[model samples]
Target: MGESIVITSGKGGVGKTTSTANISVALANFGKKVVAVDGDIGLRNLDIILGLENRIVYNLVDVVKKRCRTKQALIRDKKNENLFLLPASQVDDKSAVTPEDMKELCSELKEEFDFVIIDCPAGIEQGFKNALAGADSAIVITTPEVSPVRDADRVIGLLQHHEIPASLILNRLSVQMVERGDMMSREDVEDILAIKILGLVVEDQEIVNAGNLGTPAVLNQNSPAGQAYLRIAQRILGENVEIPSFEEKKGFLARLLGR
Candidate 1:
């Protein structure tokens, strides 16, 4: 059976969707049949990030409403035959689907793929619950900021409430900022969130450019974030890969804060 995983964060713009898209592609590249489900509902962009938006005709809502078959709604990746996308509806409201529906869809998808990754929407609301309901594991993404760390902590607590095993993905870390005592280090983020580090994606403009071009950074081998995401995907597949730190040093302030 396939594994269902949700990439989520309580705060928006913390690289949840990007991580989902990239990791899904990376997993597919590893010869795994992967299906990425956009659980963002009204604000769906997983399709765009995967560069499959233009090919989407039927979405998740269409499948739920029996307007189309699941196979028909799934958009196959142009580059990887094993990678598919189940996009969220643009016209429908967020309340159109429930956690039970997500669970059913995941159960069905599991029979067909090796991995099912859900790109959860921000906040610890219905959308979050729905996205996590069917996930066997979760990737909680955050940034180096204290606010994002706090929000990630809250999300971790909620995931624990649901009895879901979750790992942390610290995104947008700046090595230079950490050296200058301007940003939080990986240890600082893990210390605050109190979760195992899954991976760290350094701040890279290439990720932004890739997003603009409707392609995930993992598809662009030149991006450091892409390499980091590939490692994350390998880790998710139970590979004993070493997680790297994106910061140069922990810094004096970090050490002082720890004391």
Candidate 2:
């Protein structure tokens, strides 16, 4: 059997969707069969981030409502044959699918793929509940900022209440700012959140360029964020890769992030 991981945030613009895309690709890089499920029903952008927007004819809602087969909604990645995407409906509201529906779909998906990565909508509403319902474990995405960290804490509480295991992926962390005392250190954020650090991703121009080009930063061998993602992926698959610190000679990737 496979595991389902929900990538969620309490607020927007914290790179939740981007993390989902890259993480899915990173897992696929290991030759695992992976599916990226867009759980944000209405304001879906995972498709756009994954650059599979033009190929989506059916989506999650379609499969739930029996408008199409679950197989019909899956859009296979052009580059990674093992990576697929189940897009979300742009018009349907959260009311269109319930937590029960998510659990059922996720159970079926678990049978088909090695990993099911859900991209949750921002906030603690029905969308968040639906996303959390199907997850075996969670990756709470947040930046090293006050507001996002606070919001991520709220999400973490909810996850705990549901008895789900969760870790933090501190995104867009600036080591320069942390070193200069201009931004919160990784330890500070972890102390506030009180969760295991899954991995850290530094703010990088390469990540932005990869998203713009409809590719995952993990595919790039030299990207600071890409290298960090590869390490993160290794950790997810039960590998014991060390999280590098600023003083390490491994360079920027070491100082970037981890859990």
TM-scores of all predicted structures: 0.94, 0.94
Clashing pairs in 1: none
Per-residue lDDT of 1-259 in model 2, one digit per residue for the tens?
8999999989899999999999999999899999999999999988888889899999999999999999999999989999999999999899999999999999999999999999999989999999999999999999989899999999999999999999999999888788667788788888898899989899999988898889888999889888888899899999999877753233455547631
Candidate 1 per-residue lDDT, tens place, 97-154, comes to 9889999999999999999999999988888988998999999999999888899999
- In candidate 2, stretches whose alpha carbon ends up further than 4 angstroms from where it belongs are 247-259
Tell me, by lDDT, which candidate is best: 2
Give candidate 2's error at residue 130 in angstroms: 0.5
lDDT of 2 at 112: 96
Q: In angstroms, give how far residue 127 of model 1 lies from its true place.
A: 0.9
